[model samples]
Every structure is written in structure tokens, then in C-alpha cells.
Target: MNPKARSYDYTKKTDVVHSEILLPKNLSEQLDESDIELDFQRIADLVEIGETTKRGKMKSSARLAREWVLCGVPELTRAENIELFEQFAQQQSEEQGVLSMVFVHDPTAGDDMATTKAAAEGKSMAAPDPRNIHAHILLLTRKLDVSSDSLLSLGEKSDSELSNDERTRPVVPKKLVGTIDPETGKKIQQGRGLCSNSEWLKNTRKQWADILNERLEQKGIQPVTHKSYKDLGLTFKPTKHLGKNASIAERMGVQTEIGKYNESVNRYNHNQLEQTANSGITSSQQQIARSQRWIDAISTGDAYIQRQIEQETQQEKHVNSRIGQGVRRRAERQRPNPYEQQLKTSADNRKQRATELRERTIIFDRASERADRNARYRKPRINGVIGEVDRLTMKTALLFSSRRNESSSYTDRQKDILEQFANENSLVTGDFREDIRVTTTFFSDADNAQTHKHIVKLINDPEREEQNHSKTSKFEAESDLNKSTRDYVDNESKTSNTADLSVSIAPRRYRRP
Candidate 1:
């Protein structure tokens, strides 16, 4: 019985009998009542049941009893079935160290009353069935500690009255060791009570089956196994267990939903088996064809085909070996490289230096332009803007100041800035002097005040008197080249137009006359 409260109703079962107990025969004989009160009292005595304290009230809802229904084959005699159950109960008591009360129940115990009813219906009494001879065993959850010959001292008393060590001590024997509590990260202390071990109930079921099989083997009967249909390699669908209500309805010739489900499962299993059988034919043909190919390959003994196969096998082996080596080499190359790290560091440093220099150059150029516009010596403005003449004057002064300090050794930052600027303007050459010259010439001509200021700031500061030097020297070279090109083009165009005009005038006068 599960949900174990159901075991309380077993006292109402008239066919139940107590055939086994751990106590002396004198004490056992004293318990003769066949009622629920006697059954509860006996169970409480056997397990030494105690009350649990809950909300300041003493209650006892803990499991005090467990029951099992043991059935035997119809081939076994009534005495043989009883002997089998007795052995099973005794073994369970010895292993678990708990007391178990066994009872043999006969389904035909009230056959006389059943026969009288059948006669009233004009039916004869049916023969007794051997399958109805089974046993019911009620097991105690607590182990017995028999300290004295008296049965009253056999069970555990209240744990509160015991010492701390004694209360913590196990009531049942430990069957396993080294088990740990997952939540606490500590070794689990076992030996609490009977059925506390998870394997206890499972082992009990297997133990009963083993004992029953042994008895059947001794009687020269086919042994019954406890395994499921799948475990026994059977393909049939198993039926579900019918509970009390369903069992009663079935006995009264009432069909149930479980019966319909079982019928459908059986039909499905039959179809699956048929499909498997049909597929087996195709599988057999494929197997035969494979065998025939093997036989032909062996009988023909074609040297060319055999040699070709051997060569192909060797080629495949070589290819696989090469591929494996290539993979290993690639993995090695993917590892970090020290030389590449060093080169990357060097490139990063150069880029950072270039960025700083470029920023400084822009700031210096902006300041120089602002200072030139505010200078008192600047030319008077025309239409609220300074003429190009004043801009040229500032450029000439800065250029001369830079040239004066050209002999000074340049810092690494300054050198890098100039080189980068040259590279950007596509003016770099193998000669350092020529590269600098071309870079400066482009900057001066393009009105790049930023580069010009950066260069002047890198050199020594010029005096105020240097600004008054004639601007004639800076414009003389550019002015002469421009004047020569403009005079040549004007002279050629004037000569050609004069010749065309004279020819046209003569033709018009001749036509008018």
C-alpha cells in the first residue's frame, strides 16, 4: 500500500493473517484482535513509533507501516506459495534489520457465501482458482533495538530524552559510505532508519523475484522474470495496471478507456511489425548483392584492376599524410611572432610622432595668421580686408627668418614632420637638401601659412627691424618671368589681327565702287 494511510484499512480485510513476527511466540500470541485498533497498536509497538512536535502540539503523521502484495503462479500449491512469502519476508527483516508482519490471504475464503448466492441464480459453484492464493506483508519503517528479553524494550523511545550523541547516532545500519550532501558539500551521515537508503525499496523488489524464481526452478517449472517486456526483448505492447475502481468495473463486464488505449497500441505494434517484415526482404537482397560482388572480385583475379586499386590506396594514404603535415605547419605559423610585434611597435611610434607634429604645425600657423592681421605695420585695408600686399610682406619676413637658422641641427620631431609633409605633397627625393628645397618652394607658393610658421618657430626669432627690408627682392624673380611670357603672346596676336583687317578693308572698297 502506498500513500501509506491505506494500510490502516487492511484490518477490515478478513482473509489477512499474521504468520511471522520478530518477537517471542508468547508476546505474539497475546495480540489476537482482528481489527484496525489491534493492527495500529501492533505496528506502533513494533516500530516504537513516536509523536512529532508541530506548532506546540504532539502529532504522529510519520510513516509507521508499509505493505506489499505478493502473488504466485497458479502452478504453485497453497503451501508452497506461503513458504515462498515467508522466506521473502524473513530475508527482508534480516537485511533491513526491521520487523515485518506477514499474512497469507485466500481469495476463496468466503466461497460458501458466494456458492449460496450462485445457487439462488440457478448457477453451480465454480472450482477454486490457485492464482488467488497470495500474501500481504506489513513492514515497519524503524529498526528494532532489543536491549532486553521483554518485548516492551524492543522499540525506540522519544529522541528528546536521549543524550546529544545518542540522538545523533543512527537507528539503522549504514549500507553505503562516502555519500555526500550536494547542498552542504559535506559527507552524508547514513544509518538514519529503515527505507532511508534509496536502494532499500528497489533491492527488496528484486530480492523477492529472485527468491520466487529459485523456488520455481526447484519445482521443475519455468521460472518467472521480473523484467519489463522491453528488457525481455519482446515487441508486444504491455497493458496498463488497472486501479481499484477500474478493476471492479472490469470484473462487472464494463469496458474502460484504458482498455481502448491498449487495443489501439496493440494495433499500432502489429502494423510496425508487418512493415519491418516487408523491409527485411529488401535488406536481404542488398546483402546478397554485396556478397556476390565480393565473390566475383575474388574469382576474376584481374591483375590490372588489383594493381590499380593498390596504387589508388597508396595515393590516398600519401595525400592524407601530406594534408596532416600541412595542417600542423599552418597551426605553428599562426602562433605569435616576436619580429612582427617589434615592427608593429616601430610603425606605431612613427605614426604617433607624425600626428603630434601635424597638430603643432596647425596651431603655430593659426597664431601667426592672427598676429599678422593685428600687426600695426600691416598695409591699410581695402573694403574691410587687408590687401595681398600685406600678406606677402608677412610671408617674406618669415621665410628669411627660417633661412637664417637653416644651418641648425633639426630635432627628430621636426625632421619627421618635414619628411611627412614632403611625402604628402609628392616632393620627396633621394637628396635631403633637394627634398627640403622643393617642399619649402611649394609651401611658399601655395600660401600655406601653417608650414611657414612652423618652420620660422623652429628657427630663431627675427628682429623688428628685419620686417622693413625691401619686398622688391622677393617679387623681382617672379615678376620678370611673368612679364616675358605675357609680352610674347600679346605681340603675336596683334600682328595677326592687323593683317586680317587690311585684307578685309581692300575687299569691301572694291565691292562698293
Candidate 2:
């Protein structure tokens, strides 16, 4: 619980099912405190000495009320908890005339956070253990005076704070106790606070356990302990209580120092319990052996017991194997593998670095084939060939966003890939620069303009059926797409052409073993 929360937060909390202002037994009978009229806000103002500024507001460095969420028996209902709080408050707190406000926090399976933001926003950031049933008790250090006939006056700081020597002496005895100032001739205690001694705190815990046990026993439930394993003479370490932050971390499956410690403690306690159980069984067997006659123990009975033990061992082994496999499977799937994460990160980095390096030098290499065709028959315009050579000599990264249209060296999605890379690194896509394509050439003979024109005429002309069909068949056989490309040497006579086509295809490479 955050101590800085305002008094109104108690009533507004989603976890808080019911809240009421509680009075001491004597005051409850003597005074007529209206439940409808009284609230946490009014009670807080009455307890603290507020300021006398414009409208006499509470002064100084922010008024903060400390909050303690007293966890009750989970089995207890909201009403039972409120009742438990009343009994505990009256008996343990020594609140003779103290007015206290107790809020019963009853949460659902989906609950919950109690801070003002969570309550106001109506959402839970950290899903609490639904089994955790608790209460919030707010009591003022100042006492309610019953001496006044008409009005109940909020008196000086209660003896509860004064009783603790640690709070009085070192912290400021004169101000806290309202001791008369020698020079000012005034007794003032604007900052009234409460702090319990270690003995009192221990006693309060013991009392809580006692009262909780009483409640549990009434419902026929097993009573739990407030004492440590050491105090109870058990061979196990006690777990430390995880506070808000640690609990949130633990719930999120994050390993905190306290959470790890708790896990080890729980494991040790479980093992100790198992050992105790085994010892009990052994002790029972010894008793049986001692009680039995010598002949009864020796032959048939011993053999029967041995057979029973062997069967049980086999059955236990089978069950344990199944459980072990299931546990291992779940751990593998559900547990975060650090090595797997590291490898994934490494692979991503490697791939990205490789991509960047390729795009950086793509101005040079083409290993895997593009266009799915041999480059032997491509032809380029005289101007385009000269322009490409000149552009290469400049040795600069060309802007890649507009370069994908160059069908020769760059794929259509080359731009998208580079843009994605740039976006990932928060670099501008337009600034992702690389020059691969020669600007005017196409990658394939299918991109040839004359081939497209000839195919269109073959399909459209109805009169040239015989020529079209004959040529279409021949074209389909001898690379239909690249048949009779713009590069010219007579088909029968292998002679060089007089002039070049506008688009260039790479010259055929000789394959060698």
C-alpha cells in the first residue's frame, strides 16, 4: 500500500468492498456519530491540525497518511473481516477513545490494485493473488475527547506514540509531546505521528495470528502460523515478504532477489516435509516389527512386505517418470531461453549487416541469375552503353528509391527492401543510396520492344494465320522470349552486326570445369 494516498482512496478503491468509521466501544455507546455524515475525509481533517491560510487549509510539506494493509484470513468474507478488524482494533491498538476507519478489501479472481490511479481508472496493472484477502485500517494519533457535552473535540496526541521511547526522545520530544516552550510559552504539536516499538509490533503480529486462528478454527479450517520455521523448530528457511515492486516482478515471472530466495526456501521446506513423512513411516514399521512375534516377522510376512515395497517402488517410478517428462516439456516451452534469445539477436544482426554490405557494394556483383534467362542475346543502344560507363566512373551511391525502374540490374522490390532497411535504422528512405542498374537497359529479352511489337501483330492480324502459326511455333522452340533478339549476325552465317540494339544483354560466358 502506498502511504502517500489520500483518505478518500480507501472508499474509492475497487478492492475495497466496504468501509466505515469505527469508534471505541465507550464512544459508540456515548456519542451519536452519524455514519452518513462521517467519512474518511472529515475524520482526517479532524485528526490533523490544518492550516489557517485562505480557507484555513492543511499546511506544510504535503500531508501524507501512512497506510498498512493488514492481510486477513482468505476464507473470511468481507463482513467477517470487518468484524475481525473491529475486534483486533479495540483489543490490540489500545484505542480507548480513538476513532478509526476500517476498510474491508474483498477482491475477485481478476483483482486488483488499490492505488488511486488504478481505482480511478478502473484497471489493475498487477494482477494480485485472488486468494489474498486483506483490510486497510486508518487510525489517527490524536484522540477524540468525550468530555465536551455538545461537541467531541479531537484532543492532543494519544499515549500510543508517547509510549514508544524511540519515537519520543530522538525524533523531537518537545514538539511531539506538546512540551511547553521555554521562550515562546506555547505548547504545539502540529506533526502528530505514531510509531510502535519492536515489542509492540511483535505482540500485534502474535495477536493477529491468534485472532486469525480463532476465526479459522470457527470455520474448521487449518490454522497457519505467523512464526518462522526456526521458531517452530522446523528445518527450513523462512521466506522474506515481497513488497509491492518485488511482488509485481515475481508475478511477471521475473526473478528478484527475494523471489529466488523464496523459491529455494520453498524447495527446502518441501524436502524437509517429505523427510519427516518418510521418518514417520519408518518409525511405524519399527513399531510393527517390535510388536510382532519373531516367527511372524521372519519368513512369509517379510517376503510379502518386500514384494509390496517393490510393487510400490515400480508404480512410483512410473508416475514419477510421467511427471518428470511433463515438467521438463513445460519448462522448455514456457521458460525463457537466454541462449535462444541471444542467437536470434545475433542472426538478425548478421542478416542486417550482410544486407547493408550487399546494398553498399551492389554497384558491382550479381551472382544469382535475374530475369530467369541467359544474358547472351541482349543489345544496348550506343548512347546507353556509353552513358552507363560514364555513370560508373562517377563512383557515387545513386538514390535507390527511384532506381528500381531500371529493369536490368535492379529488381522491382529492391527499392522496398532498402526503404524498409532505412526505416528500421531511422534513416530516410530517399537517402538510402545505391547504384546497380544502368538506367536504360532491361534484364530480359521479354522486355525487348521489337519482340513485344511482333507478338502484338501476330495476335491481332487475322490474315497472316499460316506465317504467324509457323513463326510462333519456331519462336516457342528456340527460346520464344529471346528468339531472334535485336543483336544481329545472320542466323546461318555467324558474323557480327553493323549496329547495336538500344538495350544490352550481357555477353555469354564460356563454362569451364
Candidate 3:
């Protein structure tokens, strides 16, 4: 407990704009102590006397009080902030019947370590922001016993000080089965349990956030949230809570380990924001490029049809060189076309992948919140390291499934993004090789029909130049090929044509003979 009014004396402190003590409404008149320090001192002589009217005289060394420093918006004055703390105090009083002291301090920036350090080092720099307006809430754990008419005395532990089970247990009634306690004239029934659990803490935090946001709204400022960054879908590192001593040392320009770490965290969060903004811009550009490519592909379909018609028209003429080449060997057959169906399929697949990635991200955020909502900045939080590791492994498996189902190929950009996501969350994803796999082997017989139709076009030609430019040898070679092809070519032309073979006869005869 903070004694000697050094930290608690807001009335005398220049930075303190206001100070007030809140007493339980239903307590006796004498229980209202104007001096907060006196109530704090009287706590030492307190005794946890059971339900008996006998003169209580034992002293206990239990905890006295817990102090909470309530923060406020700098723009709001002490009076505006008072309304917020009033609701907080009222809740504690009305629900738990506890005593509280509120001290609202004027703006003072204990926020900057760099500027403070520079000033301490005698650098000529502008002063840092003096806007850390906040309040001190000192809550006494012991309730004031009002049974005695003469002296103000400390009583049992406040409802907030009691454990969950202790508070939940049914209180013993003043009169049990028509039996009255002979020690006291009228019996006192035990009070209800106002002790806090995890749910209660969460509600309390939410209530505080709501109250603060309401005050901020009244001042026309932005609101704040009660949830963690992960829960809010914010991808950034969280700052650690530097205790009072570390915070004081930091503000005084004395470098603390946690202070330095917090600065790094701040820098990281800022960078994260910048990266997210840049990523958004890049994604928009990529989307526009994709749409342009789609339009171009659609127009190319018309070009493909036009090209096919030109090829058909060319087939009617009988050019010697054209006849020498097989029909399937034409350049038109080899020309590549952007298959509209394949493009559509690919687009649909990518869209599905984006949806799955988004869903998985949501699930991961929820899982992270469920795992470390309470001690987010603390190591080995709710779900310990091993549990977290296992969750991450499962997440890795899920991510692998998502990525594996993606478009057949993951580009460098996609891989980078995935790696970045995993790194940001401290996750070791499944072996990336497992992401894309060729399940069913695919073979494309792009070559057209090898029917006799191809053979009919394949004309044999002699090396006429070798025979001193003689035309008879070439003519005779062509005649032989023509005669040999006439039998099967006619039948193939009328029924299921396939090219019988390449021009092997002349080449073999020329070589063997």
C-alpha cells in the first residue's frame, strides 16, 4: 500500500486538478472518513472477527488495499473524467460495498523516453507532450464495520477481496431454523458475493472501455476498444506493461529494459501499419492488371477463330511445298491460344483460395484470442508454449490444405505473403513443398491425327540437284509414293483417317541401295 500521502495527495499536488473520497452509501454515518489516509492507517488494527457481537480484539496481517491508476483523455477536464470514475466507483460500491478514493491529476506526459533522455543529456530539443492526464483510484479491501456506535473500525474483507468460491458459497442467514444467536440482539445476514472471476474481469474491462468511450464521445474525440489487437484483426506486436518503478525511471530518462523493448514494439507496430497500407495498394494494382488481362484474353478468342478460318481457306490450294509438309505440321496447329475455359477455371480457383485464406485468418485470430486473451504480452500465457506450438502446427496443416488447393502454381509474391503471415504469428507452417503437388499425371498429345490424310499430303521428293538437276528421278519417286498411298489413302479418306507413316520408303531405298 502507498502510505505518507506522497502519491495519494492530489489536493496539495500542483498537477492534481481534483480529489474525492467515496464511502459506501448504506454504511453508518460515522463510517464516512473524510481523510483517506486515516482510513488507510486504521486498516492495520482491523480484525476478521466472525459473526459475533463480542468485543473484537485480534489483529490480522492480511492485505490492506490495491491501487489502480485510471487513465483519462487529455482533452477532457477533471470534471468530465470524474463522471467516468464516478460510475466505476458506484459499481464497486453498490455491488461490492467497497470504499474508494479518486484523485484526478492534470496533464503530464510521462510518455516519451527519447525526448526525456535527450533533455536529460542537455540536447536543445522541443519539450515532449505534457498530456498524460490520468487519475488514481485507491480501493480499501476491508469494509468499515458500522455495528459499533462509538468508534469507526475496520471489518471483514471486502467482497472484491474474497475469492470466487468464498463469495459464491451461500451466506449463513442471521437466524437459522428459528434459532437466534444469544451473543447479539439482532443477527446480521451475510452479504452477497461480489467477487470477480474471469467473466467479471472481462465485463469490468468492457464497462471501463464503454465509460471512457462515452466520455470521449462527449468531448468529440475518438473511441477506444477493450479487445486485444489480434481479436480486433490487427496484425502487430503488442507492448509490455512496465511496472510503476520502470515507468517512473523511463519518464525520468533512466533507461529501463522494458522501456527500450516498448519503444521497439512501437516501431514494429508502426511499420506493420505502413506495410499493411502498402500491401493494400499493391493488391489493388494486381487486381487491375488481372482484369486487364481478362479483357485482353476475351478479345483474343475472336482472333483465334479468325486464324482458324484462314488456315481452312489455305488448305484448298495445292502448293508443292505445302503438299510436301504433313497437314498436321502446319504452323497454325502449333499456335498457342489463351483457353477461355482454362482462364475461367483458374479465376474461379483463385477466388475460392482467397475466400479460404480469409476464413482461415479469421479462425486463427479467434483461436489466438481464446488462447491468450488475458496475458497477451506475457509469455506462456493461457495456452502454454507446448499447447500454442501444437495449435500452430494444426494451423500449419490447415494453411497447407488451403494453399495446396490453390491455383496449381503459387507465385513468388504469394509465397512471400504466406511466409510473412506465418512469421508474424510465430507459426511454423507445414513443409512448403507439401503446398503444391501434382496428384494425377497429365499428358497432352498436342500432335494432330496421324491418319492417311496426313500421308496423302506427305509427298516424297528425290535430291534432284544431286542428279545434275534431273526431273525424272524426282517425278518417279513422287509417282511411287503416290501409287503406294492411293490404296489406303482412299479408304482412310472415307473411313476414320489416320496418317500411316512418315516418308521412310525413299529415304531407306536411297540409303540401302
Candidate 4:
């Protein structure tokens, strides 16, 4: 036998003779033994109930232990604990002589009861001893009672309701242990446990904040504020309210309160600028109205604004043009026509007659001046006189009115040409020189030749449309030639620059490795 396995004397030499062996002082000279065996299987039944029960479930170790103790009580049926006790006995037997110490046996077999009863009644048995059995039972019972009492004192709870002790209920642990973020001090949610990754948590909070902020903005609220986690009972150092970047829900809560204040302020100031624009009474008022129109027009979206601006600009231009036309007509009626030498009846009639008379006088003056200047140097010719008369008449018509047209019948507009010529020639040097005063000049020979050529061309052109077409074609050809010349010059300059750039970069290839 191993020396370490040697048995020791359980009853040692006493200090006071072991205090008389602590013998029973009861009737029949027998010690009173606890009849309860405190089987762990019965205790395990209570544990199972605590683990799976819909109500009063065990959450703490103390609660779990109390539940086990309650299951092992005599109130539970012994038949339900047969297998539990057998397993317990099997495990205990494996321990060095522990089964013999407790005298464990299946209660259904009714064998260990007799031996246990005999030993309790002061008889010998194949087990350790009746006293040892009693001690084990007492120890197990004490442990159960302690755990149950502790749980009761701590006010174990399973629901929202509080226990008699008034202690706060503990939250159920989804995980055993988890790391919390130092910054947030909130339990980080992890896939492995209850906490998550710090970055993920932050992102989630940010997303939530964004959503909340959007909702608040939709309701016309702004400027959100929320306390930091530290202020809200977290383990991290305290921080100020999340003034600009709080989660949406928290921000929204604050925004709702501020929105009322903003609404009142807006209402009070509503008419300050907007009202002035709507009241159209004075020049300043009209200006304000116009400004508001521009603002209102622009506030509408891009497409609407573009259309409105175009329409308003066009309308204003048209109205200004009509006013201009009216002014011009009135001024024309009031203005003195330069050719008119004769007086008229009414102011309007005088103005009209003055305009007509002015044309006739200008025509006469031009023809006479040309004829007198020519007659002094050379003999008169019919073609020359006709050219002079025609040129003078064209000048008078062009000068007097824009309404005169070369395309109309000559008879209709030729009266001014003949009458002015007759008036100029009617003043003879033989008797009357007063009518021959020259105040203006006439067209020169080159101009006259050019005008005659143009008139001849108009007369020779068979198709009216062909004449216009020829003129337009000449104009278009000239314009195209100018554009082409510009393009050719630009292209040549660009090509030269590009060639210069290519030549410049040619040396750069030598620098490569």
C-alpha cells in the first residue's frame, strides 16, 4: 500500500477528552438523524425547472443553486429522482470510498433503507457510519438553504415587476463577457458575443442619426442636440451634447422642441419683405413688386424660370417698342419739315404742309444748283438734264419720306421731281433772280452714274424675285468668302503651332532610360 494512502485516526487524542464524545442526550440513547438524503438528482430537477421555466427562471448562480435545492426537497416525488440518485451514487462510488461513506442506494430497490435504518438505530452496517451519512445530508441541506436565502435576499426577479426587497432586476445576459468601446462606453456588439465592432457601432449610429435628421427636416425642424454617452450613464468620460452630429432619433427629439420656436419667429416676420412686394401703389412699391416678381420667378425651378424670364423680357421689350413708336410719331408731327416754305391753317396741317413744302424746296434747290453750276462751264444736254432731274427727284423723295418706293408707278411719285425742276428753272435771270438761292449741294457725276446704272438695272430685270435673289446671293457669297478667309488663317496658324510643338518635344525622347 502506498504510504500516502494510509488511513488516519478520525478520533484524535482530545484536549478535554473530546468533550465526552458528544453523545446523544435523547430518549433510547439514540442520536436523531436527518431522514432526508438531499439527493442531487432531485436538486437537478429544480435546476431544470429554473433553466426552462416560463416564469421565475434562474438568471444568477445563486438563483440556479436555490432552484436546485427546492427540487431536492421532500415535496418532490422520490420515484422521479430514482435515475438521478442512481447516477449520483455511481459518481460518488467512483470517488475513494465516498459511496460507502454516504451509504447510497436506489430507494426503489428498498435495500439501502433497511441498512440505513438499522445503522440509525445503533446497529452496524457495510457503509462508513450513520454519523457520516447524517453529516453529508446536513451539509447538502445547509448549502441549499444558504443559496435559496441568498437569492431571496437579493430579490431575484424574472419580469418587469420588482421583488419584495425592492432591488432592481438584472438584465439577462445574452453573452458571458464582452468588450466595450472606450469612446462610447457602450457594450460593443460582437458576433462572438453581445458587443459589436466599434466602427460598425459608430456607422450604425451615424445611419440612425441621418434617418432621424431627415425626418426632422421634412417636418421643418433643425439644429438638433443630444447629450454624449458619458452624460447618459456610460463608463466613458463625460462629453458635451452631440450638437451637430447626434443620432437622428436623439436629434429629432430636440428638433421637435425647437421647431415650435422657429415657427413662431417665422410667423412674426412673415410680412416684413413679402408684404412690401405685394402692395403695388408707388414707384418704390412697383420696384419692390418687380423685384419680388424676379425672386418668385427664380424660385420656381430652372425650366419654369427660363420660360418666365424669356416671356417677361419679350413682353417688356414689346411694350417699350410701342411707347417708342408713339413718341416718334408725336415728335414727327411736332417737328418742322425742312422743305416747307409755305404756311398752313392748323398746327397739324402746318406741320404736314411744311413737311411737303420742305421736300419741294430741297428738290428745287438741288436741281438749280446743279444746272447753274453746269450751265456756267458747258452747254446743256438732254441726257445730262434727265440724269440731273432724276437724281434730284430721287434725293428729294429719299430725304422727305421713308414711304417713297421706287417699285411704285413713277407718275405717283414723279410729281415732286417735275414740280421742283420747273420751280428751279422758272426763276429766270432775265427778270427774277430771287427764286434761285442755293442753300444745299447735289450728287456728283460718279454718284449720278452709279444711280443711273442701278435704275437701269431695276428696269431691265424681268423677274422681280430674280433681282432680289441676285442681291442676296452676292451678299451671301461675300459673307462666306470672309468666313473662309478667317478659317484658313486660323488653321494655318494652328498647324504651325502644332508643328512647332512636335519639333520642340522631339528632343524629350533622348531623356528616357
Best by lDDT: 1
Please state every model's RMSD to the true fold in angstroms: 42.3, 35.1, 28.9, 49.1
Q: Taking the tens digit of each residue's C-alpha lDDT, what string does model 1 give over 128-215?
A: 3435677777666555443334343335432222335444545533543457657978765644343323344456678888998898
Question: Candidate 2 lDDT, tens digit per residue, 1-513?
Answer: 223334433333466676767767666665664322456666655555332234445445432232456887665676787788777766633543566667766666223553334557764455666667777776666666655445555665555545564344334555445777688787644332445566556666788788888988788654656776676555777789999788866665678999888888877765565444334322332332343333343324445545655665575567556655765665567658856755665575567556645653452233212211222222233234333333321211222233333421233343455446435534343322212222112211223323333322222221353465679888787784465663332553443232333124547679997
Alpha-carbon RMSD, candidate 2: 35.1
Q: Score residue 128 of candidate 3 by CA lDDT.
A: 36
TM-score of each: 0.38, 0.40, 0.41, 0.13
| TM-score of candidate 4 relative to the true fold | 0.13
lDDT of 1 at 13: 51
- Candidate 3: clashing residue pairs, number: 6
lDDT of 2 at 360: 35
Residues 389-433, candidate 3, lDDT per residue (tens digit)? 232222323333343334313344445554564455343435342
TM-score of 2: 0.40
lDDT of 2: 0.52
lDDT of 4 by residue, 196-312 (tens): 334433543454345445544554433132445443332233223332223222323434434555555544433322222122111222333344454444344345435645665
Model 3 lDDT, full chain set: 0.52
| Candidate 2 deviant stretches above 4 angstroms | 1-12, 33-37, 50-68, 93-96, 109-127, 146-153, 163-196, 272-513
TM-score of 3: 0.41
